[model samples]
Target: KTEKTYELQLLNSEIIIDGKLNDLGWVDVEELSDFMSINYGLKQIPSKKTKVKIACDNKNIYVGVKLFDDSKKITFKSGSYDDFIDTFDLNSDYFIIEIDSDHDHQTSYAFAVNSSNVKSDYLVYDDDLIDDNWNAEWISEVFVDSSGWSIEYEIPIDIFRYSKGGSLTWGLNLIRYIKRHNEYMAWVVLPEEKVGIVSQYGHLKNVNFQQKKTFNIKPYFAYDNEEYEDQYYPYLLDENNGDISGLDFSGGQDTYSLSQSNNKIGFDINYHPNSFSVLDLTYKPDFGQINQDASEVNNTAYETYYEEKRSFFIENSLFFTNSSHNNILFL
Candidate 1:
């Protein structure tokens, strides 16, 4: 296939982001279609049809998608927030969009959604290496009907890093997976040797990225009051021999009620001086509030491993991508 490019235009008005394509701002926009399968080196037309449209404003990028299939037979699945499903799995329908905001082929941000409207976002490095632990705040809506399914996304521009000024162009790629047929289709289909990567992607032109200072602050206060019963130790002398008794021979046991209180206050700050740099600060950040890890029973002698959930360490952990498969690394 040849190189493809889509000219994105500025939105005329605010989009409702309701997963419907009936909005007037979506009218007359270019529709990207004609997806080709890159499965097993065979380039053929997929059984289903898929169409995508994109628009942007000063603060957010808007995307609308329409995929045609039998709604009754569609398989839907959901995962934890910010967690992605297996693309090759036969139990779920998947859609993904990757964008190289800085036009750096080595890095890109991927946003994905399934038929159940479960959204996930991550960072891709060196074309194939992915950091799934990365997280971002974005919005998506999904609607399924008898004909097929449609999706809408509102991705904040501040969530990504990009070039500073002038007319901008970004690398773009789209992927669709059909669960029933186990088919994979892509807008920019590549050769068999170079499949499923971002080294060679299409272009998004006419992008006017707005760069401004953005700050997000979250403050929390926790008050913990713990009350418990405590047992009191008594000094009992032997009745016959004035010696210390080894055990408490007293018939009555003394008990007392104790209470403890703790007050904690903290705040987290995420400051974006511009689209290219970020500063994260925490005043007594609370790591205990993160979701607990899933329970697993290990029957063998080996230790059970757990995934990291702290944002302080998982944010830019992709820099050491060459070290190991794990995202967070300690030097």
Candidate 2:
């Protein structure tokens, strides 16, 4: 298989994570342009133009993409949160980037973002199986203008599991989905059968990265109030006809009380033990922001299974999954 390679330039200055790509670091790096459509016949020229630039520094890898669409028919879904993992692919114009940090071909990380700046990520293994629940702490932004849209990504080195090195070669592929036209394009031409074939990904060379040991602590506090009501049947007696001789159970008494307000305090600690491993610790974790499962009705005898939505359990969940089988074994 032929592989295309690009030598990443070392960033000389800091790069702001804004969607605009006007930084000196990005201007100095070489860009990979003229994306090809997946269909071989359409490879001559793509309807939309895409240009990608890559740069790396000691702590992070930077990716800038400029997509030009003459029609400017952009589709974006509005939401309260920035990260919309479940519906970003179906409802908006987006891009997906597959990265094999170790270049093992057995496993890869997929990151996606839409024109609305909503993000979705996952870990792919065994060729096609995807763990959409996976979440990573990365910076991404999108900006749309009259001509088209542009996106910038700043991926931290700690988010990936790779051997500590100075210069390394990795596997990478870029894919764009135009929702309005239902068009798919890629940086590397791929057959329809090999659409998501990570093994066929091109090569990214001369990635000079320095893994830095870092620690982060996030503390949170929450309060809630709850009210409770109690109801019980009351014993009844007739005074005129000798009380206690007959019992009437026709009425019930109700009692209401307000319990003490609930107060919670917790923190999450992240420690980078090495370049290839990370340790996370949490207390009283809150998963309120996690997306709820889709409503389903099952009348069959077998029970239905739902994906894990909690951020604490979804991040780096492959370690807890049994790769030989499809079950996730949490010990």
Candidate 3:
């Protein structure tokens, strides 16, 4: 089967990162308006109109989408931090952009942003397993008008590892989820048998990118105070002595103490030698933001596995993943 393809034009002028697509540079870029429903067949047109435009610069790829919905009601949940996968439906309207930078089909990156500008990103492997803990440094904004809503995205080239400095072909797909109508539309129609749509993504051609090795250093200091009462017994007198036979047992009084404080200083360094290799070094790692694993009842003989949500450990974890074993191993 032939796949849909689009040629990304290089931006001549600076386009504002705002959600409004009023810039002059976007006028020349071709708009891809032929979208199909992901739920229904490709022949049926969706109720709402959707158009997507793509452009690129030396440092980032810019994507602009205009979604025209006639419905007055729109669904959206407002939050900043990551939410549980089960709670995604409670959020408002959103869109997803799945990209396979390496065109390997074995792995792809999925970036999504809701109407509230909340981000949901993941790393998909083998069109099956999804690592929701994967996070990338990207910017996206949303604007709502009387007609419909629009979204603009700026994805840094540093977030991806691909062959640079020439005409490159990458797998690309866009999905728009209309929460009010419970509609799912995509640029490339996905079959029901397919689990992850990244494996069947269409092609994005003529993408020429200039790669630069970048380094980042993040330093942080934290001070914490803990307050708790500690009880102690300094001494214990012998109660089995014959001299105290007429009396009862004897014991020393308890002593109590107050709180304590601790302070720490650390730094994390991220260095990219090339597109394929990344080195992450940390002096003192902090996992305060990571949520505790949810409680689950275990009735099976095997152990239940929980996903890793820490940002430092999840980034670039695909490189260390073993597909045969379906596990991420540290070497």
Q: Please, what are the lDDT tens digits per residue for candidate 3 over residues 232-278?
A: 55543366763433323255456586788988777778998777668
TM-score of each model, paired residue for residue: 0.87, 0.78, 0.81
Evaluate model 3: give its TM-score.
0.81
Q: In order, what lDDT does every prediction score?
A: 0.82, 0.76, 0.78
Each model's RMSD to truth, in Å?
3.4, 4.6, 4.3
| Best model number under lDDT | 1
Runs in model 2 lying further than 4 Å from the true structure: 40-44, 79-87, 192-196, 218-225, 229-268, 282-306, 325-331
- Model 1 misses residue 40 by how many Å? 0.6
Kindly give the stretch of ten consecutive residues in candidate 2 with the minimal lDDT sum: 78-87
Model 2: per-residue Cα lDDT over 186-299, one tens digit each = 877666556456677788898666767878887877788887767655446677875665444555464556687888887778888777778777777775445666689999
Q: Model 1 — which ten-residue stretch has the worst lDDT?
A: 322-331
